[model samples]
Structures are given as structure tokens and as C-alpha cells.
Target: MNLVLTVLEITAPVFLLAAVGFTWVKLGFEYRVEFVTRLAMTLSVPCLIFVALMRTDIEPSALTTLTLAAITAYGVLTVLCFALVKLAKLDIRTFLAPLIMGNTGNLGLPVALFAFGDQGLGYAVVVFAIMGIYSFTFGIWIVSGGGSPTKAIKEPLVGATLLGALFLWQGWETPTFLTNAIELIGQMAIPMMLITLGVAVARLSPANLGRAVWLSVLRVGLCVAAATVVGLWFALPSVALAVLIVQVSTPVAVTSYLIAEKYGADSQDVAGLVVVSTLLSIVTIPLTLAFLV
Candidate 1:
């Protein structure tokens, strides 16, 4: 009834933007995913993160608590997913990172924004930042068997997170003109990410979909459970807890497939998980929001 419409109002625009990308690709339009992703990550996304963190009125202590909670939730997921991978006899390198690192950025941010507005976006950014740090460091190490920790430090998003956090801690604000400019750039991030997600999905060639289906189901279940436990244990406010649950439980990121391809670890299988899990998210995310809202 009213609840269903509310959820739809929140979710419809996200999938529709994605559908535009999917349909564009299907119609044989030219879309350079690599270039778009690089632009978003390096410029737009960093701007978004920096601006959001700088302007957020959320208490520093609350953010610190959520940070610890996100870390604990990921730790718990890592342990659980490792056991699950071992039991399923899947390639640990390929399956583990994707399972542990959900699509918190491309999918999670926008959903949070739609469902809970600016404050939700701010909270979601914290979770996304934590996920980004881990994915760049530990997630890469797992996939490639070797990676430099310094590389993660060099990432623009990481740098932005650090800078933004410092600004928040100091209660500093950028000049009005600069803040508005950065915000304009930041505003581009969500739509670009959503459309890029669709383009990536339209292009992925998933394999062994049956295996991917079950694995995706497991991933969703495990992420929601871990996030729930950690959020409640930390007593995160209602919106923060709900944001954490949704972000952690998002579908497998397309980057996992790209990393697998780069590192030579059954990219097709990872692609399968990405596609299946993302498609599965269309249903799972809204349902989760139905309750959270």
C-alpha cells in the first residue's frame, strides 16, 4: 500500500538510470566504461566524499562508532565468507573478495540518499570509505596475491576521505564558492555511478549462473546478518544502522570482475556473481528498504 509506494519512490530512479545505461549499451551505443569509471573515481567521487564529509553535521563520536562497527562487520564477514568459500570449494581468490566487498559505492550511496536524504548519504559515505580502504588494500592483496599498501594510500578517494575527515574534525568550511563548485562535481557522482553500473552489467558475460545464484544468495544473507549484528551491538541510530545494513548487503561490485580479469583469476565466474547478484539486488534492496523506511 503506502509503504510499497514509498519504497518505489526511493528505488525506481536508481534502477531507471541504470536501465538507461543498459539499454544504451544494448542499442549499440558507444560508452567507454573504463574512461567513465576513471573520471568518476578520480574526480567526481572524491569531490562528493570530500564535500559530504566536510559539511556533515553528524557527531564525530557517532561517526567513529560507525567506523568501528563497519570494521567489525567486515571482519566478521571475512571470517564467515572464507569458511563458506572453503566449504563450497570455490576459488578462494576469486570468490572471497567479491563476497566480502559488496557494491557499496555504485549502488549503496544512491539508495541511502534516496531513502534517507542527505544525512543518510553522509552515513553511507563512512561505510563506503571503510569499504574502499579495505578493497584497495586487503581485497587487492587477496585477488592478486601481492599488492603495495602504499597504492591504497595514494588513491584519490582515500586522500579525500582523510582530508574531509580532518575538515570535519576541525570544524572547517571551504569558501562558499569552492564548496559549491565541489558540490556540483560531487552531484555528478551518483548518477554517473548508477549509469555506469548498468553499462558494466550489460557488458558482463556471466558464467555458471547457477553457482553464481547460490553464491549471491549466500552473500546477501551473510552481509545483512553481519551488518545487523554489528549495528545493533554498537547501538547505531536507526538511519545509520539501516544504511549500514543496506550498504553492506549490496550486490557484488563490478570491480571485482575487473580485478579478477586483471589478476587472471576466473573473471567470468566473478562476472557471473556480479551480474546475478546485481540483478538479485533489484528485489532484495527494495524489500530491505520497505522495512527500514
Candidate 2:
């Protein structure tokens, strides 16, 4: 009973903020998704990642373990999702990337912060960074049939992750005033991302929701299983293990839809994934958290 309430308390603000964006769009308001996304990705999210890594109190060894665990989990997920897509006779280009990558940034970060505190947020950031690099590189290639690996290196998120990792390793701190300013900007990232997630979902036009429902269920199951195996294999600490499961099991990201739309890989199918998977998370996240917490 206590655990149920704790899970709700952690997840409520995330969905509520997203709901605000969803409602705002339904009421016929203009929200430019591309602009908001650019702002968050280029500025706010980078700031958030950098500061979180720099200030994190988690041991450096723990961070490295989590990083390797995340990489292995995603690697396993890629192979598994590929096999599933082939077996289902789905369009591999359209379904593969979305299935493999979860919404680690907009959804995962905030949930980690609320559920596990600052240290958890720190661990979540590492997984998110790993996903960002993979999504920009391999995810793009899968969606577009060909993508430039160089583009991943050019992403602000990648730069931030590398820089942040360096700072963490060196035990360096930015000047007080600078850190405060960066922290303020970083603080905007969570709410902005949550609201943007709602706005994006509101605007998406889903198709084949029946298929999407089952696929989403499979996605959550496979992701949780893979993350659990990898976490145990790495012997991750309790908090890190919980964060790994939650982050990897997050719903399909809105970016998957955007990529499909841009690359002409059946945008409606991807949109179905984004909508169905996110709706499904309202149940799955709390249930998983109930166990983890």
C-alpha cells in the first residue's frame, strides 16, 4: 500500500506535465515542436547532463559499471528487436529503431530524479547519454537506410556527455556563479521535456493501434528482461539496477516519430508506437517501480 502511493507520487508529475501539453494542444494552441526540441537538445539538456555528471556523488567506478551495463543492454536489445521485427514481418526500417531505443531523456530522467533522488538522476543521465549517442548514429542509420556516423559526433548531447565524463573523472568543479547559472538552465530541461512529450503525442496521428498495443507490450517486456540480465551480469548496485530497468523500459520516444516522418519510413506506424507505448507506461512504470522501490 505504501509502495503504491510512493510510485504514484513519483510518476504523477511526469504524466501531469505531459497532460498539460496535451490539453494545451487539444484546445487549439500553437506549440512549435521543432523549435522547443532544438532549444532543449542544443542548450538545456546539454546543460543538465553536464552539471549532473559534474556534481554527482556516485563513485566513478559505479558510473563506469552503469555505462557498460547500459551499452550491453542496448546491444542485446538491438539483436532481439531485430529478430522480433523479422518474425512479425514488419517493415524493419520503420520498426527497428523505435523498439530498440526508449524515451530515456524526457521520461527517464525525471522519473529517476523523483524515485531515486540526485544520485539516481546521475545514473539515469549516463544511460540517457549512451542512448543519445546510439540513437543519433545507429538509430538514424536504420531509419534513413543510411546515416553519417560523423553526425553523432557533431551532436551537442554527445559533446556534453564526453565533457561531463571528463569533469567527473578529474573531480573538477566549475566556478560557483557559472555552476549556478548552468544548473538553472539544466533545471528547465525536465519540465520542458515532459511538456514537449505531451505536445508531440497530441499532434501525432497513430495508425494500426491494435498492432501497436501488442508491440508495445513486447517492447516493455523485452527491455526489462534485457536490462535485468545485464544489470545482474554487471553486479550493479541496487539504485543503479533500479534506474537501469526503469530507464531501459521507458516507452518509445517521440523522436522516433520525428525521425520516421523526416526519413519517410512510415510515420503513421511510428506515431502509433509513440502514442500506444506512452499510454502503456502509465501502468508499467508504476508497477515496475513498485517492485524496485
The lDDT leader among the candidates is 2
TM-score of each: 0.99, 0.99
Per-residue alpha-carbon lDDT of model 2 for 1-293, expressed as tens digits? 88878999999999999999999999999999889999999999999999999999988999999999999999999999999999999999999999998999999999999999999999999999899888988999999978888888898988988898899999999999999999999999999999999999999999999999999999999999999999999999999999999999999988888889899999999999999999999999999999998
Model 1 lDDT tens row, 1-293: 99999999999999999999999999999999999999999999999999988999888888899999999999999999999999999889989999998999999999999999888988999999899889988998999988678888888998998898899999999999999999999999999999999999999999999999999998899999999999999999999999999999999988899889999899999999999999999999999998899
Superposed Cα deviation of residue 178, candidate 1 (Å): 0.5
Q: Give residue 192's lDDT in candidate 1 (0 to 100).
A: 97
Residue 111, model 2: lDDT of 99
Output the lDDT of residue 1, model 2.
80
* Local error of candidate 1 at residue 147 (angstroms): 1.9
Please state the error at residue 187 of candidate 2 in Å. Answer: 0.6
Candidate 1, residue 63: CA error in Å? 0.5
lDDT over C-alpha atoms for residue 293 of model 1: 97
